[model samples]
Target: MPTPPRVLTIAGSDSGGGAGIQADLKTMLALGVHGMSVIAAVTAQNSLGVQGYWELPPVAVRAQLDSVLSDIGTQAVKTGMLASTVLVETVAEVLADVTVPIIVDPVGVSKHGDSLLAPDALDAVRSVLLPLATVVTPNLWEVEQLTGIKVDEENRLRDAAEAVRALGPEWVLIKGGHLPGEPVDLLFDGTSEYRFAAARHDNRHTHGTGCTLASAIASHLALGSDVVEAVGRAKEYVTGAIEHGFPLGEGIGPVDHAWLQRR
Candidate 1:
């Protein structure tokens, strides 16, 4: 039997199956990778908005990570929605021994504008989690949340990328979807920089975009693609997902994770 490309997601759980761990696992499966998850938080949410959330105890989170990494092994690891400082530190400690590529999705807020990260956890994420990242993916809001740099236009993206690169990641992918006009992302890898631009989709069902993009990048990385190549394919995948996003509950819906499979 062929060895399957394995990717792990350390993130919150979305009972609605739109974003968080649900979206990450869906993206991995759609991209032909075996997906594993160590949920950090459990959220009571749907399209309308987040109703409640509970952070998993650090011990439980560590146990799950230990079980997965010690047995199945991960080719790549992607993280999202660590609710508290303790959770962030716990994940950082658990991943210290894993040698594979790590993709950090500095998830700060939900698609519905609900705050996900605790104000106290910013320091832990910046100091501990970011250094272990092979690629740190931060959207516009998250960049400002983490670095205090405002990204108003294309030019400021470089400034923001630079601020995040200073934190210690090998690469930084600053998503510009929240900006106007064409959607573009800036990637900086210390010595070099690359910009990826895509046509903006007019769809409103763009939930789970951040999680899906990060997971897709991890999937490509597990498949042996380089940073640039993995990011390029991930952008293409997310664009398609956004264009075909699905309308679910009463509010913003989820991106169409199965769209690629049916094509």
Candidate 2:
């Protein structure tokens, strides 16, 4: 037996097991990486929506980061809903000096349109957290939230990417899934640009798509893929997962993380 590449997720926990830390860990396992978690918040969430959430104390978050990084350091890191200004700052401070690849998924709301992040915390995410990222993945709504730029058309994805790049991340991935037609995501690092397009599955059960994609990217990075390659592979994996998505609760369901294994 050999040790697998390790990836850590710093995020909220969704009780429903569809998104947040749950999805991150599942995606890591599917991608053949060991997944570790540092829970920043806990949400009473299900397929219907988020009822409420509680943020852990800053000391607890710091302790969790130290406990993981000090003993079993990870090869890559991925972040999701931090929920508050202090939590965002706490995570940013700890991840500042980490040399491994970092993936930032600026989760603003749930699949059912429930707000997950505090409005006051947006500045900290743009200033402190995003700059420490090796790559920042923001969907259309998040892009508009972080940088006042709304991407309504596929052609405007570059504009949104550039706006986010100015915030200091080495790479920016603008997810155009909200736009009409097939989903097209643009990846840019100031100079080089790459676009990944996937067939849109006509399924309404895409609850954890964002979390799954970001975690898959982190997993591939931990497994020695470059940023471009990692994003490409992640896009493919998520497309399959979306295609195989199954209904869970009464509301939206989750993408199948083990879609590959099922086949």
Candidate 3:
């Protein structure tokens, strides 16, 4: 049998199994990739919110990256929450030499509005990490945080994507999930553009949507999809996951990573 496409996720661990590393790995598996991980931080998180987090030492982060890339190489990589400036730099340095397509979810906050990326790390992400990304996925909130470009309204969303694109990633996807009306996510490479619109499910349980979307994109790229095709397919998969999203704990629940099989 042919070996499964291998994918790597370098992100924080979400104890709730809703986002971060858990979500990324689950999305990879659901999309038919062999998921590998490098835990950059561990969070005390649940349906409610992020209570606290502790970043792994830079040395440990590097070690894990080396361990994965040295032997079980990945065809694609997805990065979620690297919680600190040091962690961001560490990940950026390691990923710089990797030739695989990288999908970076510039995770800035949790579903409950808790900050995940360190303020000090924003510059590192802009300078070091974004350059190494094949694509950077940032929600409206993150778009403002990273680029000082406010996506306060729909009209300015494209301006925000261009600002993020200016930071160096070959592609930028500014998710407009927080905006009113139907959810519209815009994906732009320097030249062309693609807009993905989905009927906004009224459900409030979309805790892992960001992580899942980025990993799904990485998985599609690993499967040989072009940038536009990968983003299109990832949007479809995430929409299905959101549609099947079942409520979990007292607060927000997770997107159903296994929604495909369950159907």
* lDDT of candidate 3 over 1-263, digit per residue (tens): 99999999999999999899999999988999999999999999999999999999999999999999999899999999998899999999889899999999998899899988889999999999999899999998899898788887778878988899999999999899899889999998887878999988878889899999999999999999999999999999999999888788899999999999998
User: In every candidate, how many clashes are there?
Assistant: 0, 0, 0
Model 1 segments more than 4 A misplaced: none
Q: Model 1 compared with the native: what TM-score?
A: 0.99
Local accuracy by lDDT, each model: 0.94, 0.96, 0.92
**1 or 2, greater by lDDT:** 2
Q: Which scores greater on lDDT, model 1 or model 3?
A: 1
lDDT of 1 at 6: 99
Model 1 lDDT tens row, 79-176: 99999999999999888888999999999989888889899999999999999999999998899998999889888999999999999999999999
Candidate 1 Cα lDDT to native: 0.94
1-263 in candidate 2: lDDT tens per residue? 99999999999999999999999999999999999999999999888999999999999999999999999999999999999999999999999989999999999999989999999999999999999999999999999999999889999999999999999999999999989999999999999899999999899999899999999999999999999999999999999999999999898999999999999
Estimated TM-score for each candidate: 0.99, 0.99, 0.98
Superposed Cα deviation of residue 1, candidate 1 (Å): 2.6
In candidate 1, how many Å is residue 259 off? 0.9
